[model samples]
Target: MQPNEIAEVLNRPLSQELLARDLTRLAYVATDGTPRTVPIAFVWNGTEIVMCTTTNAPKLPALRHNPAVALTIDTEVHPPKILLIRGRAELDLVQGIPDEYLQMNGSYEMTPEQRVVWEAEVRSLYDSMVRIVVTPTWAKLIDFETTLPSAVEELVKQRAERQGA
Candidate 1:
């Protein structure tokens, strides 16, 4: 997809909901040449998707070796809102806690006292974290209303041709 097309899909209201969502399934190739998909927390900053992980995360090595990745963000409803993305992972190791991490988890409900405790624990446990940043090269949004899957579109085309013939 062209950059403008990707941006248009991502800027749609339904896509915005997916971007606001807390989790996305991150898909990448592992070191053993196997595909791995894991549910991970993410924060989309309009231009990029940022996911924080431990400095020594297993995915880090795989991402470093092969930067290509895909992500799926969707809903569990009947007419699910789906967002598919393809991008390259750029790992940035930041000292101390990443603010994006905190902001991404901020939506979860917690008592003020619990929040403080959680922050302390997170701060004490990790000295640094790896931010996996993905700048989308391609994207598609399927809300099943304004848009349909490519396969569905093709099926519709065949049906119309047969009727006309």
Candidate 2:
């Protein structure tokens, strides 16, 4: 997909809301050639989705082997709004905690007192971090109210034909 196409889907109001969401399910090919999906916190910086993880994380090896990835950000309402993104992962190893790490984790709810403890724990745990940067190559927004997945759209047509047959 062209850059304009990616922007067109993600720039919509519903897509923007989903992009602001705290958790996105990331799917990628594992090092063992298996598919893996995990819920992770991410921050959208207008153009890219940034996530942080430990330098020695198991997922890092898989990501290094296969950069292609998919992300799903959605709401849990009756008629959910979903934003689907396909991208390539760019790994950056940083000496100190990256800003994206803090930003992505900011959505976790915590009392002021608890937050202080949490921050302290985070500070003590890891001396280095890795930033996973994803630049969307393709995108789809499905509101159910307004749109549907491309494959589903095709499936609906097929069903109609079968019914007529």
Candidate 3:
């Protein structure tokens, strides 16, 4: 899809809400030529999705070999609101822990003092991290009310045709 079209989907209210969510299931190709999908934390800056992980993270190697990725973010409620995104991952090795890492974990409940201690531990442990950035090449929002899956839409059309006959 064109950049403008992707942006249009991303700007929808449901998309915006999904972007605010902390968890996203990232799908990528593993070295063995198999598919891999894992739940991870992410921060969506208006333009791109940022995911931070340890430099030695297993997924980092896989991502480096295959930068192409797909992300799914959705609500758990019935007739779930889902945001599907396809993008290429850009891996950046940043010195020290990235601020985005802390920001992405901000929603997790923790006392102020606990946060301080956690930050200290993190600062001391990781000297560098990999920031996985993805710029959306395509995006779609499925809220079930206004939009239905491709299969469902086809079924609806078939049903309507039979009913009319």
Residue-by-residue lDDT tens digits, candidate 1, 12-115: 98899899999999999999999999999999998999999999889999999999999999999989889999999999999999999998887788998988
- After superposition, the stretches of candidate 2 with alpha carbons farther than 4 Å from their true spots are 155-165
Model 2 over residues 1-165: C-alpha lDDT tens digits? 999989999999888989888999999999889999999999999999999999998999999989999999988887888899999999999887788887777788888888789878888897989989999999999987678878888998899999995
Task: Give me the overall lDDT of model 1.
Answer: 0.94
Model 2: how far residue 95 lies from native, Å = 1.5
TM-score of 3: 0.96
lDDT of 1 at 83: 98
lDDT of 2 at 45: 99
Number of clashes recorded per candidate = 0, 0, 0
Every model's TM-score:
0.96, 0.92, 0.96
Q: State the TM-score for model 1.
A: 0.96
User: For model 3, how does the per-residue alpha-carbon lDDT over 92-129 read when each residue is reduced to its tens digit?
Assistant: 99999998899998878999999999999999999999
Which stretches of candidate 3 lie above 4 Å from their native place? none
In model 2, where is the ten-residue run with the lowest total lDDT? Answer: 96-105
User: Which of 2 and 3 is the better model by TM-score?
Assistant: 3
